[model samples]
Target: MATAPAANDNARPSRLGPFLRSPAFGLVLVALLAAAPAAAVLLGQPFWLTMATRVAIFALAALSLSFILGQGGLVSFGHAAPFGIGAYAVLILADLGFTDALVAFPVAFLAGALFSGVTGTVALRTRGVYFIMITLALAQMAFFTFTSLSAYGGDDGMTLWARSTVAGQKWLKNDLTFAYLAIGLLALFLVLGNRVLASRFGRVFRGLKENESRLAALGYDAYPVRLVAYALAGGVAAVAGALLANQTEFVSPAYMAWQRSGDLIVMVVLGGLGPLHGAIVGAAVVLVVEETLSHLTEHWKIIFGPLLILIVLLRGGLIARILGGRRG
Candidate 1:
């Protein structure tokens, strides 16, 4: 007792420290990324605005993946299933003459949730490499199933004749309107995800990731928590997909390809796992790099692949370099 150290010995630093070091850095990056499209619009560059729309859509998808893969330590390679389903949901609904965003978006989200809920229940039965393989297999099943559907574009994909109407308004068809919608929805999801991470459920899920046995020993069933996170992540990814279909005015089986899932994983790792918000940063970086490098060389992957390896090998990559987080 006499040797006990003062409780204040481990007191935290001033608020300004974390703010200046990591919080502010992250905020600045987000602002710049969000503002890029607006700047492009102001400059009369509609192409860049469309590009920004892609960035925002992927940002939302990556953000959702961060929840499960980043915080919950669930390496799900089947996330693309829900994403592609969301796109198809929108397409199918529109094909049925239900083109209203208000109706279509919820249906898309529910479709994603339904797919993830079923898949997660089974996928969570295994762990490590087995989990990864199972996820990949399930996703491929979806890919082939969609490919067999000759009614729609099937393997060739389909072009949307029109964007979703918002409350019967056709503004969603406008590029600028869609861009803002994507950006605004992304920001909302990011904020919502941040809140969830701070909640008790998030804490427990993270703890399960760190030591599932320990959490289970403490009387918490890890299955439901992981399942919920998995499903929620899928639903969110689906939202991104819906926006993507709106942005591109197209839907395809390609959206569910394993390659896309791998790309999502790359974004999570590239952004670093500490705050998870870095997922958006990673998406922007990946998209921008791909856009830039593709123009410079036809074999961009030959260049991009090694760069990704380098970042993952580095100490927590860009987020660590800028934000002072521990290496992953």
Candidate 2:
């Protein structure tokens, strides 16, 4: 039988590997993926530009989820609550004529912080399945609450007259520019996330995932650490939501539904939970498969269903397995 490595063996320092099998390679690949739309534009294919843009947007969201779910084993099933709140922040403010990205973006971050602050406090009191259920409940509450708001078009959702302006300029309305913006933000967040994961806080967070009791024995308080990580993840997810509103130009209560949260989890798992950028690969694969399948048939999910299962069974994930090399 294949046995897991000893803790000491797992603790050995790591080094970058071959181009085809390194985390650095995966990141470089992601950068090229970001540039793909520009290449498509050169080829006179506007449709691919739009699809690549969506990949950037969801990649941001799934990247946020990766911080907690992929890195620390914090299974937050309510990620969509903050994500949807971020979208609604843009929509509601735009409806009130506050369409500047500066104003709306901050509001979205605050909204996510608010949700995470309240629910995370309560959810952190539990662990395992209890924690998962609490997160789901909180997400559903946000969903239903938004659905009941008739002023914002309730369950039907609201649309924006125009994309959020940057410094009072309509830069994002341009498809190519918007794609670049999304890619830029994704890169920025990826850098920020890497710092967080590489820091002492991240080590402690991962330690808790392995053994909370042992970490506690070492004098680290899990509550505060977990709470902070959860809040940060929520804030990041909300930023993704804000960008998504600009991409879709719509906000609906449906964004916060439990199923969307599940999709985020799927993206994290599909990308491979080894490194942070795995989520990017997962997001692109999910969106591309979904888009391609949808065009082929109305019941495309039936086809996608088996395909996803086969993927899981065959390789678990593409980027983490191939680019990241064999898992420890």
List model 1 lDDT by residue over 1-328, tens digit each. 0222232332344564376334445556567767878799899887798888888889888888888987887888877888899899899999999999999888888889888889888999888888889989999998898888888788998988799999999999778888888888887777787778779998999898777889999999999999998888899999999999888889999999999998898877777655666777778888989999999999999999998778766535754445433334
Model 1 clash tally?
Answer: 0
In order of appearance, the predictions have TM-scores of 0.91, 0.90
In order, what is each prediction's RMSD in angstroms?
5.5, 3.6
TM for candidate 1 is: 0.91
RMSD in Å for candidate 1, one decimal?
5.5
Deviation (Å) of 189 in candidate 2:
0.3
Where is model 1 poorest over a 10-residue stretch in terms of lDDT? 1-10
| Weakest 10 consecutive residues of candidate 2 by summed lDDT | 1-10
Q: Which pairs of residues clash in candidate 1, taking residues 3 or more apart in a chain or in different chains?
A: none
| Candidate 2 lDDT (Cα, 0 to 1) | 0.83
In model 1, which runs have C-alpha deviations exceeding 4 angstroms?
Answer: 1-17, 20-30, 325-328
**Per-residue lDDT for 1-36 in model 2, tens only?**
133234232223345434443446546856887778
